[model samples]
Target: MTKTNVIRQLEKAGIPFRTAEYEVDEADLSGVHVARQLGQPCEQVFKTLVLRGPKLGPFVCCIPVAEEVDLKKAAEAAGEKKAEMLPLKELLPTTGYIRGGCSPVGMKKKYPIWLDETAELYGEIAVSAGVRGMQVILAPQDLIRFTGAKVADLTIV
Candidate 1:
């Protein structure tokens, strides 16, 4: 189910995307390893983080896994005082996707997605493809449109 209709969102939105598959070892699912495996810089690989905000409902924020999320900053971006990284157990059901497979797109509900401004520095960015061992590469701006995400300073600045 991860690959089936998950990618349809990209097509329906007319978003240009490319697929990269790799062997996902039983290791920590982080941006560093993903970038290494994909043969791309860590900054080019975006990690989809699911956080629960008190005021903004559930929101999906994407940032370089190489960089840590500024919880308070994320909260402010979501118009809240703070945000917390939800537990994997809580996140799976809340997002209707697994941790390593969680994508900012194709969610159970439409969330206000936010991308760290730094990600826009690159012409291409990589994100999880609704499954582990898979990534989809596309323009950062296209991702903003596909997910209707707001591009903002969502970093720990």
Candidate 2:
């Protein structure tokens, strides 16, 4: 149970959260897999994605693990004409997080965050704890307040 930067940030913010740790399966880094490992529903586990727009630079979208981001909707949310996923090679340098472990919180900079509206359906949701095989479970409203995230329809229907 290592205290990752995400955990430390939440503590500093006085946000209450619980951490869950599980074995890391490099071959199955999907959020759905993580949720199953934690005995939770896929809709309650989110995956953080970083996307770049020509005008907006970078922004983050937190969507349910089982859904795919709708690039057109994401662009509209970010006020851009189009958006593209950030390349894997640039993730660490840009956000200080790697794939399968990128959390919406504790990035190098506070890029604008858009959380899928579906999150409101749950009282608590799980997101990466800034490391692989770990997740932070917290109230969705608390997370929204802490990150100043805008809630929207971010996933493909």
lDDT, candidate 2, 28-62, per-residue tens: 98888899999999999999999999998989999
Clash totals for all candidate models:
0, 0
In model 2, how large is the Cα lDDT of residue 145? 99
lDDT agreement of model 2 with the native: 0.96
Question: In order, what is each prediction's RMSD in angstroms?
Answer: 1.7, 0.6
Query: Compared with the true structure, what per-residue lDDT tens digits does model 1 show for residues 58-140?
Result: 88889987888888888888898878988788877788788788889888888889999988899999998888988899999
Clashing residue pairs in candidate 2 are none
Regions of model 2 farther than 4 Å from truth: none
TM-score of 2: 0.99
Best by lDDT: 2
TM-scores for every predicted model: 0.93, 0.99
Which prediction has the highest TM-score against the true structure?
Answer: 2
